[model samples]
Target: MSVRGRRASFISAGVRFIVILGLSVASCWPFRQSQDIEFTFLLPPGRVECFYQPVAKNGSMEVEYQVIAGAGMDVDFTIVSPHGYLLTSDFRKSDGIHTVEPTEEGDYRICFDNSFSRVSEKMVFFEVILDGQGAEGGGDDEWADMVEPESMLEYKLEDIRESVESVHRRLERSRQMQTLLRAFEARDRNLLEDNLWRVSFWSCVSLLVMLGVALTQVYTLRSLFHDKRRVHT
Candidate 1:
């Protein structure tokens, strides 16, 4: 090949490689239509708090909740479907996880009830994960239009895309696990602190009682001894 033709061919090859790599990365990028909500709320005594989440048909929903702080460390939880059906209900539960698959395309209700505990309020931590709803990625047609039908680049791109997707899924799971662990840790810490406070308060009260009794005993003994010495004299 002539110098100019050689240069032209090299430039074309470089452009093709770049295009393939770009398409691969774009297609493999995680375009999740999923919604993740994490919330911590206080449920007052004699009250019920409810939240709504809209989900599409054939989608999946997962709800996890924990009563992190309260008198009893428990609350009543309920899930209602779009059609006013009760899907799950738990009374006086400390923690729970619920899943709904192939959900109806409407609003779902989640409620926490603290009416039974008329004196103690509750602190709740909850998470909702909605998956497989409006995912929008994978530009396969764009890749096909830019590459030859049987090119080696196409196969390499497919491999790269799969690898990227696999890594993305693993990372997502890892993140979810970490979040759950943090919630648990917070609950445990709160419990420990509460217990410690109670113990310290009672210890102080007992110490004060002991000191009062000891002083009274010492005074009574001195008075009795003084009376006896006077009678002897």
Candidate 2:
């Protein structure tokens, strides 16, 4: 074969190999669709706060919560179904995980009640995860609008793109996990510091009280031992 022809053959072979690799990667990529929300908020005393989330029938909903900072490290959590049924109820709980599979398609309500608290407000960290058909519907249309493979090479390229997108999603998840960790650590540190301060304050107060008692006793003894009759004479 001519040198130019040989070079062309090698380039074609390389392109084919690259395309095949891309297709394989895409075929192996994993896809998932869901909705998640996280937040930290303060619930004031004598207040009732509620949030709503829409979910499709047969969908799964999960909630996890912790009292990050509060008067008692506990709060009231309640989840109501779309059909006006109470799914989960927790009173004066520091942390909990709740899950439900809804049978109706409608807006579900989650509430944090602080009405029972007369003076203490609560700071809470909570997350909700919903896995439902409705959440995946838009994703399906997006996938359909993506470029279709016209040839085997294009097919491989599409696969490569999917793999890359999967990687991107993983990295995003990792970042989110890191953020959550930091928040948890900060909350814990604050609690620790507060407890330490309380301990120190009490220790100082107890020491002063003891010293006052000792001084008072010493003065009382000196008064008792004094010769008042001799002084009068």
Q: Write down the lDDT of every candidate, Cα atoms only.
A: 0.85, 0.78
Instruction: Report the error of model 2 at residue 208, Å.
Output: 1.5
Instruction: Provide C-alpha RMSD values for all models, in order.
Output: 4.5, 5.1
Top-lDDT structure, candidate number: 1
Task: State the displacement of the C-alpha of residue 197, model 2, in Å, after optimal TM-score superposition.
Answer: 2.9
Q: Give the clashing pairs for model 2.
A: none
Relative to the unseen true structure, what is the C-alpha lDDT of residue 90 in candidate 1, on a scale of 0 to 100? 97
Worst 10 residues of 1 by lDDT: 146-155
User: Where is model 2 more than 4 Å wrong at Cα?
Assistant: 1-33, 132-169, 231-233
lDDT by residue for model 2 (113-205), tens: 889898988888888877654633354455667665655434455556666777857876686677568667867986998899999999999
Off by over 4 Å in 1: 1-30, 137-155, 228-233
> Model 1 over residues 72-181: C-alpha lDDT tens digits?
99999999999999999999999999999989999999999999999999899999989888666534454455553454424465566666667777787788889889
Can you give the lDDT of residue 128 in candidate 1? Answer: 95
